[model samples]
Target chain A: MENNLCIAGFGGQGVMTFGKLLATAVCDNTDYNVTFFPSYGAEQRGGTANCYLIISDREIGTPMSDILDDLVVLNQPSYDKFVSKLKMGGRLFVNSSIVKPTSDRSDIQIISVPATDIVVGMGNIKVLNIFMLGVYIGYTEIVPSESIWKSIMEKMAGKPSLVELNKNAFEQGIELGRSQK
Target chain B: MAKVLMKGCEAIAEAAVRAGCRFFAGYPITPQNEIPEYFSKRMPEVGGAFVQGESEVASVNMVYGAAAGGTRAMTSSSSPGISLKSEGISYAAAARIPMVYVNVCRGGPGVGVIQPAQTDYLQATKASGNGGFRMRVFAPATVQEAVNMTYKAFDYADMDRNPVLILSDGVVGTMMEPVELPPMKSDDEIERIKESKKKISCIGHPLGERVWIKPGVWDTIMWENINKDAEKLYESWADQAEWESFMTDDAEVIVTGYGIAGRIARSAVEIARGQGLKVGLIRPKTVYPFPYKAYEMIDYSKVKAILDVEMSIPALFLEDVKAAVKERCPISTYLRSGGNLVSREEMVSRIKKLASR
Candidate 1:
């Protein structure tokens, strides 16, 4: 099976980091092939930032795709720009605190999580992306949740406080995601 | 060592370091900035020298000096930046300096865009500089292949005592994938490599036995001889021509490309195969040698049409493909230029149309 995912948001929203974390986790833990490609250049300076992540059982082809099996949008502009690229029956994960889908698309599934508000409530906004990652994993179960936690630990290895905060945020996201399921 | 996930540009830098590259001087350019950025951090760890040259020309010339002093040196830049470095490249080629460089190409005739494009095909294979000198150009489709080619590029340059090119583009440079890196050359090995070239390098020797190395030869006969030797060296690279043929045994349509375009075409071939279309792919791993034999070996009896896929407007790589095919079958082209990428769905549709015809 192959899944093409695009994560998009404002430049400082950690869109690329989210994709990288997932891609790295899958690559380091499983035999699945993965590729992470970012939208770069002038557009990345205070503008919209996005990245593509492809995870496949077979060798991946192009890292960029016109159509996506899944799209994660953290802001309204990202949702407005990329929502059309999602295929019918594809999954759309959105940050409910910032993005409100104006279109009533019946063919796709929209999973809205109040990620920004939830992270703010947790007293640290930096873990917002990691929390969304947890939500994605909890819903899809594409890989084990422990794999993601292990990846988070590895990425946040140097800072003990940040690790604890991110772990708490991720667990909260997983609980919310499981409830949605 | 186990595999690790790395961006293409970073992987290329690490591969160069592992290959005993001790000196790197390059200017930063978008889509390939990571290469220089990587070297800035990595070179120090390897006990090597890294310089952020004031300009691309200076960077390339710095590499020329380093390589002339018997060090494994390299430089990288995007398309327009590479144009500025052409003079230095020509000098290195003329003086027979064994050095390696990379063109992480962006769209351009002149600063076109920062997105990936295969528009530099002609510039790389036909005319990298004014001297009309040729270099072994490796076009890798995947990060793994990029790492492998970069690891071997130093060896190729040293073997021929000439410059080498890794012709990559923005797509390949920015993408990240898992790759098994080559083993690092030990300090002793690096020292031995430098010692091997001591006699020919610019190291000081007795005045009576001094060796002069200059790109220019005032005598016409001497320049002609240098050109003749370069031609012979290029000719000897026939055995190094490499290409990948996928399911072409019974294919009625053959698709061909190099670099990332070639990679996307391979995927199209697989998708078309699932649809029961007899489509195959010929992906050239080395663009300079052109892999003419791979085209020559195509069974004319089975193949009806050849589809040349590339990301260049007028198709710069088409000339090489045409020369190799020798007009055996009708050649069609599917092109996307100026930072636009060729998609698998489009290629698959094109192959189906050719197959139906």
Candidate 2:
């Protein structure tokens, strides 16, 4: 199976980091072929940032694709810009706290999570992306929870305290995602 | 060996380190900024040196001096930055210094968009420097190939005493993927590698016996013989050039491309074949050696036409493909530029149309 995903948001939303964690987890924990391509330079300063990730059982032809099997939009502009590119039966996960997706498509699946509120309630807004990743894993199960947990630990190597905070956030996200049908 | 997931630029830098690259000097440019960035941290850890030069010209000259001193040296830049280094590159070629350089090309005739494009094919292969010096240019379609080719580039450079170019675009340089990284050379191995260059290097020799003293450039005949010998070395690479042919055994129409464009074209050919069209692909891995012989392997009687695909407006690779085919069959081009990729659907449609006729 091939999963072509686009995660987009403002540069401060950690879109690139979220994508990297997912790609690296797949690389470190599975035999799956994965690629992550990010938008950087001037775009990273204040403009919208996005990352295209492809996880496949076969060799990936290219890292960039206009057709997304899944799209995660953290802000309204990202939702507006990328909503049109989602495949008919594709899945879209949005941040309900900041983005109110206006797309009227019934064929695709939409899962809205209050990720910002979830992380803010946990007293650490920096763990927002990690929490969103938990929701993604909960819905798709494309990557195992154990793999992501281990990846999170490895990624946050130096700061032991932040690791615990992110783990808590991720678990909450998974719980929220599991409740959404 | 175990594999690690890394971006293409970081992997290329790490691979060069493993190949005993002890010195690196480069200016920062988008898409390739990571090469020098990675080396800045990595070089120190490996007991090597990294220098962020003031400009591309200074960076390449620093590499020229390092490589002349018998260290495995490297530099990297994008299109406009590479243009600035051209003169220094020519001096390296004229001095016969073995070094490695990377051009993570972006869309450009000038300071173009900081996105992937193969517009520099002619600049890299046909005219890398002002003296018409030809480097053995490797264009990798994937990150793994990028790693493997980069690890091997230093050897090719030292063996031939010429600059070796890794011709990658921003897409390949910036993309992340899994790679089986090669083993790092130990400190002793690095010293040995440096010591192995004693015969041609002026590092240890007295000033009286140095290359500058013996052949100090007032002699026009010596320069003529040097150019003649350089031409001969370039000609010998024809025997070692590399290319890949896919589904060509029964193909009636052939598609050709290089680098990432070639990778995209292969997918289009596969899709066309699934739809009962006899399409094949010929992808040249080495752009300089040009792999002209690969075209001769095609069965001209059955093949209908050749389609050249690229992400350049004027289609730079098409020139070499035409030169190789030498009018054996008709040729067509599908091109895109300014950060646009030629879509697989577009190529498949073109191939189907060609097959029907």
Candidate 3:
């Protein structure tokens, strides 16, 4: 009984990597089967880096999610383009620091958080991916926060020191999530 | 379950899918592009793998790689793109890994026109690659036969442990007709090969040290030396190629062609028969076999000529037909190329003219 998530942002916003990390985390750690598809290269450059994820108890053949339960937009263009595509009652989380004038929908729960500002204060601007990943977990526990940390370690399986910095960034993201709500 | 309207190229792809070919790798090449496009989305829906490769070389190599991993993998291409894959095709033959390659032939000798031509007949039967190995070559005259025979290509490839080519022309590939696809291989036949990767070629020893080796130089040499009996390799592909014969029991003139040319030749023979000409078609479903026995069994007393028609420039199959029926009858060529298909009326007129001369 997992959910479908769409994470979108500008070219270098780490949206594709974040989606892949979540997919790998779910597939490797959780019981929920997962599928992930990313837009890359020619068709994707300068437009938006979007990824569709399908997480369910059964086999998810098509990775593309026609219906989205959670949508996270990291830029104004991404927010403007994908806001109306979310399923009814779905949660919409906006990085208000970069994404301005977010959509106003009465039936959907909207979180306006300065995700990048929190990561910038943590002294590592690269931790923005983790900060948004934390918001994703807070809205819907599709994958455990612990698995995301494991995923960071797994991703840097060949690197040692980077793992330490990512673990710290992950903790800082959790702290930001706690202080915001 | 019954006849379905499908393009000839699409029928070939559908048959390969029904044959339990779970993996397909190919790039877009006209005259044969539909083969991959038809199966790209369809194969994945049924838990199969489909990859649109960067190029024909990469595509065939992907097939070779996946097939060596114990999955039934296939690829399709036309003349120009197929030329790039000859290296891999030879490698597949040398490895005897059983891969299906479909060549929807276009007019060739260069970047030939994207029109139906049996120009690759020599390239297919004889080694276009740098080797002495032969691939099992098939030529289906009709769309329905193309669908039925495509699965046979996979089976023969696997059973003989050799590469098999379904050589069709542009007309054969692009033409649409009613094709009733048979369940190529039983579900169990392929199910047996599902876990085949686990033992069929995987290395042995402690789990940690056992590297995932495919059908490579080590295994091929090891098996070759293990079963050094030449008869084993000979027996492997003895029954691989075959064909079809109609009214050749007592007739003299044998009209030889394959794919679209063969289809046109069939109607030509019928029209010639209506004019009291004793002409009959020798359509080869598997051109590699050449039906030498059928030609040898021809009643030479009544038969005076063998008219060989093809889309290539007197380039292929004509010589093979000559050798098969050298002492039996005189063989002549009615060849055409560069994007033109032989019509039925023209074939009949040619047969009639040849008979009179």
Candidate with maximal lDDT: 1
lDDT of 1 by residue, A66-163 (tens): 88999999999999999999999999999999898997888998889989999999998878888898888888888788988888889888887787
Clashing pairs in 2: none
lDDT of 2 by residue, A56-119 (tens): 8977876777678999998898999999989999999999999987878888899999888878
> Which residue ranges in model 1 land beyond 4 Å of their true spot?
A44-46
> How far is B81's C-alpha from truth in model 2 (Å)?
0.4
Clashing pairs in 3: B116-B170, B252-B303
Which 10 consecutive residues of model 1 chain B have the lowest summed lDDT? B203-212
Task: Please give each candidate's TM-score.
Answer: 0.98, 0.96, 0.62
DockQ score for model 2, please?
Answer: 0.65
Sort by DockQ, top down from the best: 1, 2, 3
Question: Between the candidate structures 1 and 3, which one is better when assessed by TM-score?
Answer: 1
Q: Write the per-residue lDDT of candidate 3 for residues B129-194, one digit (tens) a residue.
A: 765666667787777778777877777776766778888877667654445687756567777865
Candidate by candidate, in order, the iRMS in Å equals 0.8, 1.5, 19.8
lDDT of 2 at A161: 71
Docking class of 3: incorrect
Name the lDDT of candidate 1: 0.92
- lDDT against the true structure, per candidate, is 0.92, 0.89, 0.74
